[model samples]
Structure formats: C-alpha cells, structure tokens
Target chain A: MNEQEHIDKLMLELRRGTITIGVLSQLSSPQYGYSLVTLLDEKGIHVEPGTLYPLLRRLEKQGLLDSSWDTNEARPRKYYVLSETGKSVYEQLCVEWQSIVSSLNDLILNKGDDVNGDG
Target chain B: MEMVNRYVYAVTQRLPQSQREDIAIELRGLIEDMLEERVGDGGNNTDKMVEEVLMELGSPRTMAHKYRGSKSYLIGPELYESFILVLKIVLISVGITLVGAFAIKTVINPVEILDHFIEFIVSTVTAIPQALGWVTLGFALGEYYGGFKAGDLKLDKNWMPSMLPPIPHPKKTIKRSEPIIAIVFYVILMGMFGFSSNYFGIFRFSDGEFVGVIPFLNEAKFPEYMPFLLLLLALFIVKECLKLISGKWTMKLVVCTTVVNLVALMVVYFMITSQSFWNPHFMEGLMNAGIVEQGTEGYEIMETIWKNVTGATVIIFIVALLWDIVDGMIKVRKK
Candidate 1:
C-alpha cells in the first residue's frame, strides 16, 4: 500500500488500543452515550457516537461499568459510570500504561537496535 | 423523524430479540442528540442534516457489528477453512458418484451415446452445486449451533487444560490422498454392484476386433441389492469425509470410520455371498465364445471363478476392511 493507506491502518490500530482506556477514564461520573462521544472529542480522542454507544454497552455487559436509564427528560438517556470492579481495574491499567509509555519513549529517544549493547 | 426510526429499526433488527428494544431506545436518543447538535440554535432537524449524520455514523450493518462483537460471518473464520475442505470433498464425491451412476445406466441400456453423455454432464453439473449448498448449510449450522457437537470443532466453555487433545504421533496423521483414493474406490464399488454385476468379465475379440462380453454379476439379482449398496456407500463416504476433516486419528473420527466401514463391510459380505450373486451364465458365455471348452485349462479357470466367487470376495473384503479398522483403532489409542 501507499504511505497514506499504511499510516491510516497503523493509526487505526493505535487508536483502538487506547480508545477503551480513554472511555474508561471518563466514566468515573455518569455520562450518556452521545455526551461521552462529545466529551472525548473535546479531549481530542474523537470517538464516533456509533462506536462509543456499543462500547458502553459492552463495558456494562462485562461488569466494568453500570448503566441505568434516566427517562426524566422528553427522551430517555442511558447513563454509564465506572463500576466497583472497574475502578480497581482502571487504576491498575493506569500503572501498566505509565510503564509502557516510559519504555516506548526510552526506545524512541535512544533508537536502540540492541538491548545487550547500546549504540 | 421517520428516517431516524427507520435507521434505528435497521440497526436493532440485526441484534438479538431481548436486546432489540433497549438498543432501539438508546440508538434513537443518540440520533436526536446528534441532530440537535447539527441544527444548533435553530433547533430544527432537517432531512439533509439527518441524512448527513446517519451517513457519517455509517452503515446499519456496521452499527450492528459493533453491538454484537464478533458475529458477522455465516461461517466464521474459525470454521471457514474446514467448510471449504468439506465442500471440495463433497463436490468431488458427488461428481464421482453421478459419473458412476450414469455410467451404469448408460451401459445397461444403450441409448444414443450423446444422450447418455449429455445426461451425465447435466447431472454432474447440477449435483456439484447442490452438494456445495448442502455442505455450506451443514457447516453454517455447526457454526451457529455451537458446532455439530459442542466444542467439538473448537473451544468449549467448560474447557480445562486436561481437556486439550493430545498431540498425535506423526505416523498417526492421515494422509490426504488416503481418504481421496478410498472415496473413489467406494464410488466404484457402488457403481459396480448397484446395477447388478455386469461389465466385469473376460472380453471376447474376433479377429482382434472387440466382440460381445461375459459379465461376472447376475444382472437380474444384483439390482435387488441396489438401494442397500447405495446406502452403505453413502455411509462410507461420510466416514471418509470425517477423516478428511480431522486429518488425524481423532477419537471422534476413528470411532466413526471404524463402525461405519464395518457395517458397510457386512452389507458388502451379504451382497457378495447371496445365492446367484455371481452370473450363472458366466461359464456358459465363455463356452459359447469357444474361448474355453470342457477339457480346456481356460474352462477350469472360469469354473473356479464362477463357483468360488463368494469365497474370493469374502477374503478380499475382510483383508481390506481389517486393515482400515485395525489401523484406526491402534492409532487412536496411541499415547
């Protein structure tokens, strides 16, 4: 493929890996599907409403989030927030993410081809 | 508003029954939010804005795929390779069988050679796609219903480390050519006997030009066993297919092939040993051709074949079947 196509595919993979963590990090407070999409966009994550809605449902299914409908308005909005299990999971995930970022930064900055001997 | 409902309905219809209503409500609410954002202070949602918004969200099928997670295939990737493998075998088997069956019909009563040839081509062409459809349907059912047997094709929910299959010995692996050759062989036998023993005999030549022949089967009696022979062969072909799919001596495979082949062998034994199963006119035809006479060694050979045909057939069947059965049992039980 040309450079644009290769970059597009690689960027999709990169964004997919981080999108879950971005969504999880925001759900400490209750937010509905569309609100979550807008909230992430302001932070530059730019998740589609279609993607976020299904992901919210899946996270609820996995017991990583809890959901309830607030039908008080003219239209009902399903709200999602981090569950008890989700809180602990996200905290541990943050620790792993921090370690991975540093390791990757070190490799990128140093441009190391060998771990045994540095260039 | 109607367009929004149609889009919501399209997405939710693909989801499961229980999740449909909840997903529909949630999807409708998301659309309204997006439309409101698009219209802004004017607070009017137009058809153009709705169309643009839905188009941006993309196809309803893609929306459903996101909701359902990994269920977008009729035969998923896990089952695809096996499905194609079974399809090839089934198509080849159908082609071989149609060719054999048509050859018998054409031989028994010679119509115009072209008519039989046309019929063979037409039937084989029709049969292959029908076979393809059936094989696809079978694999699709297995895929959707958690396999023909639960976890038999892949992982089970109740899987344990101990449940993992043992690595088969290298020698125990079934060669692809083995089942392929056996399927052709079975197709031939089904063709040979189903129409009653004809076409197999010493051919007579007059002045080096081909003449009329003697057949080894009683034309009238063998057709009586036709249905049973066809059923036996169908079972044998299925067993061979299982072998082709498994590619090794899996317990499920070995047990199936051994039992099916043994039953087929029994039907074969009965058909071979039945009274007058051999053509009574075999010797008479030989004598009539003047190729053999009462005092000739050729006559003695023909008589031996005619009288002791059952014994010879029984020996051949037992030897062939015993090798297949014993080979399977031993391989499957290997540590």
Candidate 2:
C-alpha cells in the first residue's frame, strides 16, 4: 500500500517478461544451471537457482533450449544451450525488444518534455 | 549434506515422475555449487553455510511452485465470480422452497406450527450444503476440461473487431433482482400446486371459532399432473439461471430463453384443461354452507367463473411468457 511496496510490484511485473529474453540471450553457449545463475548474478540480473532451473527446463520443453548431463564433472551437472529453433527465435525477440525499448523511451521522454514545456 | 538432500527431495517430489529424477539431481548440484562458493572448494563447509544456501532458495513449496509454473484450481479466477453468483441464487431459492413447503404443510392439517418451523430450518440447513457441493462439482468440471474458455480451442485464429459482442445499454442488462425474483416466484408456485393444491380453498368461521375448510383442487388428479408441472418448473428455473449467468441481452441468450419459454407454454396449456384439475365439489361446498341457494344465478355464475378461472390465469401466463421472449429478441437485435 505504501509507495515503495507499490513500486516494487510494478518493477516485478516489468522484469517478469524481460527475464526470458535475458535468459535466452545468455544460452548461446552450453552453461550448467549453477553456472548460469552465477553468470546472470555477476551481470546484475539476480535470478535465483530455484527460478532459473525451472525456466531452463520450460524453455527446453518449448524447443527453445537443449540440455545434456555433464557427468564427467566431479558433480553431475545439466548444461543448457540454445537450440536451432532457439537461435532464430532469440534473434527475432531481440529485434522486438529493441523496438519496444525505443518506443517506451520516446513515450516517457515526451511526457517529461510536456511537463517541462519543451518539445 | 543431509539438509541439502531433504530440500532437494521436497522440491522434486511435487514434479512429474520423469521430471523428479532430473530435477532432484539438478537441485543437488546447484546446492553443492552454492555451498562451494560460500566455503572454498575443500574448506570444510559447515552446517551453517549449507543452511544459509538453502534459506536463500526459500521454502520447498515456494521452490516447487516456481519450477511448476502452471497454476491449478478447482474453480479458477475466470469462472469464480459466476460460480459464486450462481451459488447465492441457488441457495436462496432452495431455502424459500423449503420455507414455503413447510408453511403449506402446517396449514393443511393445522398441526403445531412451531414443529413445522423447526423442520423448515433443518431442511434448509441440509439443502444448502447439497447445493454448495453440486455447484462446486459443476464448476470444477467446467474448469478441469477447459471448456470455460472456448476461445482457447481456436487459438490460431485471428481476432476481428466484429467478433466482439456489442456493449449492452444499461436497460438491456439483466438486473440480478429479475431472475432471482422469478426463481423464487416459480418455486413458490411449485410448492403450492405440486404439494398442497387441495388445501387451497375457502375457510368458514362462525362466532370467531375454528371451522373446517372446503378444498378446490381434485386431490386425486394432483399426482397425475406432477410430472408435467415439474417439467415446466425445471424449464423456467433453468432459463432464469441462464439469463442470470449471461447478465445481458446477447443474441445467444435471447434465442435460448425464447426456446425454453415456448416449451413451458405447451405444458401450461395442458395443465388448465384437465377435467380433474379443479375440485368438482367446490360449488356444492359453497351452497351447503348457505352462502347461496342451490339454483340461484349467483351460484351458477360462481360455478361458471370457477371453472374458467384456472384457464384465464393460464392464458395470462402464456401471454406474459410470449412478451418476455419477444422483448428479449428485440433488445438483443438493437444496435
């Protein structure tokens, strides 16, 4: 009900859709579940292991990601990478995302301009 | 290590069988990786560190919910509002029917009225849970089979502007009171005619003392008309339910109501014409009470009027039904 809690909810909604794009962008190379978490964390996306692992499995089910077990490691790990279909899909998504970002920036900037009495 | 395995088991058990094994293995590996990052690869990872890693991941159920993103429900959000609306209408009508039935029974034999009141309360208590259970079961099936969203069946089709229903004017909206009052009215009629038609008669009194009653309906014929009357009641209640659910004058609803009313009209015609429907002794009772002479014009006129009374009411009812059907069709067709 307070302003901060309200803002946090809106921010969560904004991140929910774009998180898939972020995950897809990083799966060009095979990355294990833990490795992907650390990678995204280092890049400041901050996804949980619980959240990322399920997302990886769902994307694989949709044929947008491929997975294999790397049992050769000390601890058996499942590594996920982009599939043939995934690559094209991610490319198209990136194009759409760029257009969305530009349009949203324009809408926000124009509102600011109108408030400031400048075009 | 023990805590980590328990956590992994908790999350994987909720997933599908095939998924359980894979998710269990992946969750364990992820836990180990987190533990290693906290304590150096070979630096003794204490219980505290393992607990911290598990805590960061959240409860097992929250983790499972995230992994299984699909939502589940007995009555989902889409149909929940309509389900509750129907439940309220059904419960109130059933309660009224019980109350009316008990009241009529008390009047018939003139037994202890308090006992009838108690029985009415008890029946309403039992009827409510049965109503709730049936409505919940119905809505659950509606949700489970995914029939509620027919649009999902044609997911590949492009939506056109013309496919949208036109917004109804305020007057075109089916007021909640309309169908609710209609349902209550029909149930009261059913309770009266179905159970205690013979009891509907004239009561004589002298010196403010209790006196016997003269019945109007042929008691023997009441059972014969039960099925036909029940059919009419069912059709009318169901039509009102549909109207209540739709909440507006859509073409589909208008057509459906029209069809149901026409069927009820047929049943109403047969009801008034049956020879045994009205009591043949009604005129004799009136005359024996010294209200009229045996062959007076008043007696003959009263007899004639009583014979055609049910028919007149039936005619009026048919006309009302016809008017409702026509009015619905016209409202729906309006721009």
Candidate 3:
C-alpha cells in the first residue's frame, strides 16, 4: 500500500473501536445509518458505512444501542439510540479518553524539554 | 443468468415478512447504483456492467456476507469448525447409543452392524458440514447485517397493522386425513415390530448368515419389545400428526421431528437384532449347527443407506420448507 493508504489503514484501526463509542454518544436523538455516517463525518470523525453499520450492529447486539425502522419517509431508515447501558459505557469512555489525552500531553512536553536540554 | 436471480430470491425469500421488502429495495438500489456507476463515461453494455459488478461482488454468499459484515471470519478461521464440533458431539453420542442398543445383534452379525453405522456416519458427517456451513453463514450474516440494535431482538409486542391484506374469509376446517395418517403409521410400526423375531427368521436370515435388517432393532430379538415399539411409534406418529394438523408447527419443528425419527429408528434397530446368538440367528438356526456370523458387513451396508437417505431427506425438507414459505407469501400477495 502507498504511504497514504497505509496511514488510512492505521487511522482506521485507531478509530474502529471508538467510532461506535462516538456514535453512541450522539445517538440520544434517532439517526439512520447513512445519516449517522454523515453526522460523524461532519463532526470530523469520518466513518464509512461499511465500518459504521457493523459497529452500530455490534454495539446494538451488545445492548449499547437501540434501533427501529421509520418508514414515514419515501424510504425506510433504521434509526438508532443510546440504550441505558450505552450511556454508561459512553460516559466511562469519555473519562478514559480525557486521561489518555492528558498523559500524552505530559509525554510530548517531556520529550520537547529533553531535546532542548541536549541542544 | 435470470435463473441465478431467482435462486438468490429463493434464499433471501426466508427473510422476515416485514423486513423483506425493505431489504429487497435496499439490495436493488445498491445493485442499480453499481450498474449505473459502471456504465458511466465508458459505454459498457448493460450485460457487461452487470456481469462485471456481480463478479466483483462475488458469490451470493460473498454479497450476503458483505451486507451482513465480516461473516467468513466471524465464526472462526475455518467457518465449518463450530458446526463440525456440533455434528461430532451429536453424531458421536447418537452413534454410541446406537452401538450399545445394537450390541447383541452386532455380536451375532458384527459385519452388518459396522456396515450400518459406517454408512450412517458417512452420510451424517457429509450432511452436517453443509448444513452447518449454510446455517452459520446465515446467522453470521444476520448478526452482522441486521445489526440487532438493543431491543430489536425482542418479539415486537406492540400490535402493528399487517402490511399484507388481512385474512379474507377465514377457513375453520381441519384436514380430516391427518388423524387417519397418524393411526396408519402407528399400526404399521406395531405390526412390524410385533412379529419382528419371526419375521427376521423368515426373511432377514440367508444361507445360515445374518443379512441386512432394520437399524434400531439391531440388538434386540424381536417379539420381546414389541409393546414398547408400539407405544413409541404411536407417540411419534401422534406428534407428527398433531403438527401437520395444527400448521402452527413451523419448518424448524418438522426438521427436529425428522432428526428425532432417524435417531429413534437407529435405536430400535439395535434393540431388535441383539437378541439373536448368531448374527444371522434364523439362518444359523435353520442350519442348527454353528454360529455363522455375518460380521460388520451388514453394518457397512446399513451405514451407507442411512447416510444417503438421511442426507437426501434433510436437504429436500429444508428446500421444500423454504420454497413453501415463500410460495405461501406470494399466494397471499395474489389474494
């Protein structure tokens, strides 16, 4: 694979587990699969339907999401929501994310300081 | 080929009534979009475009998996392993039980016993692999694609209006022959088992050697357990008759019954044959000299017959059930 494709693959791996977590966080309101993909993309978290749909199903199967078909429109759209379990997991995930960010910040700054001292 | 499309429909035909149309519409849209994209700029013929897209998409299996998500690897590295595991456990247990029941008959004519079980095992083993492959494939696809979001798996308790037309002029009649059919099967099994010992002597024995006889009664010398056989056969036939009449019993029930019948028949055969000293007790009795054992030859023969018959029966029943379900829906549409 080219460097960009390799990077994309790596990025996909990183986002794979978290995309469902992110989607669940936003699914207090009902959202269909395709529309949900667009919403995640607009929010700077790009998730393709191939990845997103499966994750949504996994999360739903795990009792983290709820879905229903709304045929009110010309086309029926399956809408998903955060279940009670999903809400709890999403909250915990947010806390873990914050801690990871803070730790990374400390590590990066320490690396910068070490370089300066060496120079 | 158009025929291939019909085959695809036949498989997808079992999709739940409510979801079928939406799934079909989505599938059609995807196929159309792919075709349109292929035809764009490059003036590829429609046929070529379809062939190319379908080829890229791969088999119905691959397409089905794609929609369902990651099914080939979902079960395990080898998809057949879990089902093989299931078949191994089930068939082995049944085989052991069958052997124990038929031990007496097998001892008399060990060859026959070996032949019978070998045939059964070969057929059972072959069948289970295919069944497991398809069933696991479907389940994996459903699990992957249906994406059972929380609460969706629950039986929809909420009364939704039927999309299809309501039953017009409900028929309040039952098939009268259903009861008669059950009675006839019960009588036949009773009559067969009732004189089994005498019957084996006269028919199953040949040239002072035990030949091929029924499976479940392999161990037992018949006339001994005629009453038990009668009772069991009655229950079996009654259960089937009830299900046939009710129509409430789904295809799954029929499949279960068929499996049970095969297992029961194997047990019955072993019980019947074991009662004799010589494997071909009747023939040996006629000679009134030595124990002429037919050995495992009979078993091999039995096994072949069982495997072929069971395998064919399982496939036919599954296909018929699926076709009938789809046909039933189509009929409803017409009405």
Candidate 4:
C-alpha cells in the first residue's frame, strides 16, 4: 500500500476507539440516530452514518445506552440516552485518553522516532 | 435526488421501526436545508444539487452505521461470524448428546450405528439452508406485522421522492401462524429422525425405556388398537380447528383438549395394566373379526404393516407438538 493508504488505515483504527467515546459523550439527553450524527458533524467529528448507527446499537446492547421508541408522532422514532453505566465508563475513558495523550506528547518530544509516530 | 433518498433509507433502516421514520424526516430536512443553501437565487437543476448533497453524505450502509451509532445486535444486518459461531456450537453440542444417547441404547452393531450417524450429520448439514429460509421468513413476517400495526412505518408528505423513496406499505400483514409453519416443519423433521433411530429418542427417557405407551402392532399379544387411531384423527382435527379460530378460545381449546387427551391415555394405560387381556387366546379372539391368517408369512407381513403404521402415527403427533412450539416462538419473537 501507498504511504497515504497506510496513513488512512492507521487513522481509521485511531478514529474507531474515539468514535465510541464521542457517541457516548453526546447521549447525555435522548437523541435519535440522525440527530446524533448531525450533532457530531457540526462539532467537526464528521462521523459517517454507517459507523454511528451500529456503534449506538452495540453500546445499547452492552448496557451502556438506554433506548425507547417515541410513538407520539406520525412516524415513531427511537431515542437513545447514555445509561448510568455508560456515563461512568465515558468519564473513565476521558481521563485515560487525556493521560495517554500527555504521555505520548512527552515521548514524541523526547524520542528520536517522532517523525514516524502519529499518536 | 434518488441517490439521496437511498442514502437516507440506509441510515434509517438500522434504527427501530419506531425511530426510523423520524430519522428519515430529520435527514430529509437536513438535505433540503443544504440544497436551499446551495441553490440560493441560482436556477440550476435542483435534482443535480440534491444528488450532490447525497454524494457528500456517503453510501447508505455507511450513513446507516453512523446514525445507528454502534451496531446493535438487535435488528442489525446478519453477522456471519456470530451466526457461524452459534450454529457450530449448537450443532456440535446436539451431535455429541445424540451420539452419547445412541451409544447407550445399542451394544451389538458398531458399524451400523456409525453409518446412521454419518447419514444424520449429512442430512442435518443439508437441512441448514432450508432452516435459514424458514427462520428468515418467520422473522421478516413477524417484524412486518409487528411494526406495521404499531404505526412504525409511516411517511410524511414533506419528505418527497427526492428525499425519500416512497415504499409501498405491506398489505395484509402475515398472521402469527406463518413463521410457526417454518418452525413446525423443523420440529417434525427432528422428531422423525430422533425416534426411529436410537439417536436421542424423542420420548425415550433412558436406555431401552419408552416414555409413552406405544401400541405394538407387530406383537401377537395385542390386537389392532383401533381406538388409538381414532384418537390420532381427533387430534389432527383439533389442530386444524385451532388454525382456523384466533382468540382466547383457541388457546383454551388447545390446553383443555391436550389435558383431556393425556387423562384419557393414562386411564387406558391403567385399565390395560389392571386386566391382563394381553394373552395369546384373547388376541386370537380378535382374529375372528375379519379374514383369518392364511399362513404364518401372512401374519408376519401384517405385523410389519402395523409396526410401520404405528411409527407413522407417532411421527404425526410429534409434528403437531413441533408446530405448537414454532408457533409460540414466532409470537414471542414478535412481542
């Protein structure tokens, strides 16, 4: 693969872990799939619908999110909110992510292999 | 514009039926809002502009995955890995249990038993395609009926063809029995194979032990069990009637009838055990009803015929039980 393709592949792996964090953070209040996508996009995360929908479903299945159907409208919509477990995990992930970033930053500045490192 | 509609559907389809419509509505609004921004005072083709908006959004599966946030195990596309994992585990476990049960039943013929085992495995593997067809049909029918009745597939007029393709509402939702039929077919299949072979006999409790009192037509100690045949026909009629009627009465009828049948069987077994009417002379008295045995060979042939008939009856009853179970599963899945 070309250097650009390699970079893109690595970027995807990094983005996947971050995307779950991003989704959980947004679900403080109940939001449907599209609304969440729009909110994420407006914030410059630019997540695709494919990646978001399945992740939300997985999270819900894992007991991290609570979902309910809204039948009051002509077209019923399912709204999702972060569960109690999800809030705690998201908070922990945030703390871990910050520490990792700081540690990586220090390594990049001190180490000679900074050019090849993306983190 | 058409492409955009497809894109919107892709993302929304993953959502629960209740949420899919609102997500579609919101997506259409987003696209329209974007189109308006791009075409401000410009008389360019609105169709081309909408198509561009969709291209920027990405493919339908991708969009759906985004809206879905994460793949929920429920109502998501079938996962081959997970499916294979489950199928392998279940099939292997069933195979092991069946082998163990068969080994305990017979001691003489190892080669014959192995031959039967190989045949069973081949038959079971070949049957999976059929199983999948029935399972998918049952699930789809349940979903369509369940969601449609709940008003989860509605569309708004503002969401035009450009934003969303108008899918025809499914007319005449499948009744609950449709998926049940698929389940019934599988149960009948399993029961047929189970009882005939020693491979985990359907009603058999342990080695050489039959759970129910089965009529042995081949044995000269007892005459033909005409009353048992009549009872089977009655059960068939009752099953058919349950299919026709759909209410509290149908379920009540099934439960009450099943209980009545069980009680009648128990009574018959008790009577037979109380009176030793299984003597050779008593059976000879039954021979007086019709044509007497022409020869010993004739008696042997008659015995084989009766044995086959009894086997067929047992299979039929098993099929009915399977049908009931599959029907129940369909109902539960929909709920």
lDDT of each: 0.82, 0.83, 0.56, 0.57
Categorize the docking of model 2: medium
Q: Any runs in candidate 1 off by more than 4 Å, and if so which?
A: A112-119, B41-43, B97-113, B147-174, B188-227, B238-262, B276-304, B323-335
Higher lDDT: candidate 1 or 2?
2
lDDT, candidate 3, at B252:
53
Assess every candidate by TM-score.
0.77, 0.73, 0.36, 0.38
Which 10 residues in a row give candidate 2 chain B its minimum summed lDDT? B204-213
lDDT tens string, model 1, B291-322? 78998887888687768878988888888888
Give the worst 10-residue stretch by lDDT in candidate 3 chain B.
Answer: B165-174
Chain B TM-score, model 3, reads 0.28
| TM-score of candidate 3 to 2 decimals | 0.36
Error of 4 at B294 (Å): 14
In order of lDDT, best first, we have 2, 1, 4, 3
| Residue-wise C-alpha lDDT for candidate 4, range A40-116, written one tens digit per residue | 99998988654565566678879999999777865456689999999999999999999999998888787986667
- CAPRI level of candidate 4: incorrect
Question: How do the residues B70-104 of candidate 3 rate in per-residue lDDT, one tens digit apiece?
Answer: 44455443334434543443344344434443554
Could you give candidate 2's per-residue lDDT for residues B207-304 as a string of tens digits?
55436667777777778888888878878889988888788988898889888888887777777676787787888888888767878899888888
TM-score of chain A by itself in each prediction: 0.93, 0.91, 0.83, 0.89
DockQ top scorer: 2
Q: What is the lDDT of candidate 3?
A: 0.56
- For each candidate, what's the DockQ? 0.75, 0.78, 0.08, 0.17
